[model samples]
Target: MSVLQRVVKPTTHKGKKILLKKEPQLIEGPKKTIFFKGRKTSDKIRHVLKDMYDLKKPDGVMLTKRNDITIFEDVTPVENFCRKHESSLFVMGSHSKKRPNNIVIGRTFNYALLDMIELNVEAYEGLKAFESSKILLGVKPCLVFNGPLWEESDELKHLKSIFIDFFHRESVNAVRLQGIEHSISFNAMPDGRICLRSYKIALKKSGCRIPRVELEEIGPRIDFTLRRTKLPTPELMKDACTKPKELRVTKKKNISTDNLGSTHGRIHMGKQNINSIQTRKMKGLKKTAQERKIERTAKRKALTESNELIKKKKVHDD
Candidate 1:
């Protein structure tokens, strides 16, 4: 008997191509931040609301359609719930006939409001309502502290850490504001208030009076809010880390005995300060009290002996 060989057809009898569907990649960090929409607001206004945190939809709308950014009939219950969960931050949207495009972003802990910022929607063109489900991408916001609070106290530093923790959800270095591309300046006021101003960083032609370098103010001022609130706990702030490690103030190493230039005999007592008026060296270099007293006594005795010699010479001449 001859061996039989079978040939297989690659295509289906219906003439359809076999294809594999692409799997959607899940977004990261929505758990830390949320967008809460109020029930009374119009759907158009509510859905069109956008923040740096929200992702853009393919249909030209900003996506707030996630479980993290849910719609609520009342603000009180949602806020209370967020506090109970010890959430760091949540955004609340409210619009009315009298007030248009009102958004209140707040920081929360243990069901209490720490800081609340109210912003009204300005003119935003080309934004529509669409179904969106994407994560925040390509955001590097600069934080500028332009007032005394930048250095006067640790309060602003603590507050800044909380903001970093809330914004930096994706990676360890994601939320750092290094270059001027996109930025949020946390300008503090002397009156115990923080004026947060957001801007879109861009390069532009310099004026004749100024340098030829590119400018930083790109689009219209993004948003500004002023508020005062108690800082959140450390558990709620992970990214609010200390300042970029102060270049580690490299200490001068001890000179080794092998080096001839090194003198190890003199012990370093402490810092030195001089008193010019007293004609005295610093404590570390000062002469002993007994030595100073002896010098003074010697000078006085020499003057007395000179006077006595002059008197004896005059008596001999008489």
Candidate 2:
């Protein structure tokens, strides 16, 4: 006696699909002996069968002829036919020269073999060599083999659209976007000195114009440059407003007294000595207001006394 096992879709048989409750496990224990029976053996089918059973060519399942039923060499053609019709079928049998027995044929509705093949093709093309090797070595493949995540998900798609819009919006030339305007202001002083100031200003996109001026030409000139907008310190303003001291030039009158020889000579020498002393005192007194005022008062008193002495001496001589 012999037993047969098959896997198939459910729709063709009008039954619910056999959902794999758990992943299939490798068969354990002492290998149970089994045999294959068909009218003929095919190298292609034999190779696939060997791979499935993890068997070397010399130690694979045996194939023998049977007379009870006809057998096909490969089941791939039948599988393809089922896929085209949106159906599925599976068949298994034990064979002998006298009669074939223990035959099992099944149909399914859920499994889409064509879809599985397409998915495998995409994964094989997409996965890196290391990942593909792991899968070939019996590791479960992850979502890394799937297509672009942004193309597949709605949220990512929306984000991508927004990013594109932000980067690709209409652009304007940097020069044209900001306009330019020039201005000059002039102020005339009481002494007919005109202060002419020129500024090179930049108008920003926000409609604000900032003035930039040259500071070197700020002194007395017909066409002077404006200074930067920094406010002057109080000390600097005070220094500017304070007037400079006026330069004073003193006049000396030369006296020619004619007593012809001795008296006038003595007087002339005495007057020179007095003038020298007064000049020294005036030079020393220049820094103090009180000292300068007292010196001027003494000069006026000396002049009045000399005039009185000259009038008395003239009346006595008369």
Candidate 3:
């Protein structure tokens, strides 16, 4: 094969289609993740990465081999892997003297690096540390952000959204009381530290209609201090968050509802002439042709009588 042909075409049609850019879809599928490590990693980092992969479940792909790529330095390898694996989210673990037990959590947009954040794991705990039963595979997790710092600081705000996107499994309309099995809470400390905790929800029988709720710490607890953060530009963020036309709520005109739960609609019409309007056919309401003639004659006679009386008064004065 010629060099141009080899470079341009794929061996199979499926490969060719996979290489092509994806169009905007009305309904998106679950976000898949790729987990990998660097050439050098501490035991803590490995355990944390594996635990995260477990949380991601069937949608996650873990790469066993280590690579010598630094995401903040050059993101080419990460982007290539994202395209190859068709995964938008990634978690990379690396340990070094300067930043020990470090992990970078990031996501891609359109097979390109959109944003990433770096944090050092200060303390670690694995699932074995806790004795709670594990949650079901692919079960949706309820994420709770408990701290004013999440909204007060821009970096924490970004991290909060990123964490939600990473751990979110699917969109649901209504949740059952029994279906809520697990929850993940991100608590922001005052000293710029993060306490990531996982809990298993246990509903106990109660006399009332609502069941009593209990939370059990299910392991993989880790404390992280913020190190570095990178956010996408305003334009890129806006474009990334734009909703598809199919999902947009189109506004209806001239229709409204009031507080009383009644619907009202306004109708427009051209100018109306009362003279041409059709009225009730009752004799009392209708003016016949003879009645109309009589009314006009009475009005004319009254006017003439007033004129004659004025003339007589003028002649007497003269």
Using TM-score as the measure, the top candidate is 3
Report the C-alpha lDDT of model 2 over 148-263, residue by residue, as the tens digit.
54465443333333222211212334433123222223432343222333223343354456444322211111211111111234565355335434433343455335565332
Candidate 1 lDDT, 2-107, residue by residue in tens: 9585744447634333221111113234234555566456544454355333421211123244323232223466566574443556666666676566665556
Each model's backbone clash number: 2, 6, 0
Candidate 3 lDDT, tens digit per residue, 163-266?
A: 98899877887899889999999999998889999999999989999999999999889999989888899898888888988899786799888998798999
Output the better candidate (2/3) by lDDT.
Answer: 3
Q: TM-score: which is higher, 1 or 2? A: 1
lDDT for residue 177 in candidate 1, whole number 0-100 = 33
- Ordered from best to worst TM-score, the candidate numbers read 3, 1, 2
Predict model 3's lDDT versus the native.
0.89
User: Per-candidate TM vs. native?
Assistant: 0.38, 0.14, 0.77
Evaluation by lDDT, superior candidate among 1 and 2 = 1
Which stretches in model 2 have alpha-carbon errors above 4 Å? 1-37, 52-68, 71-138, 141-318
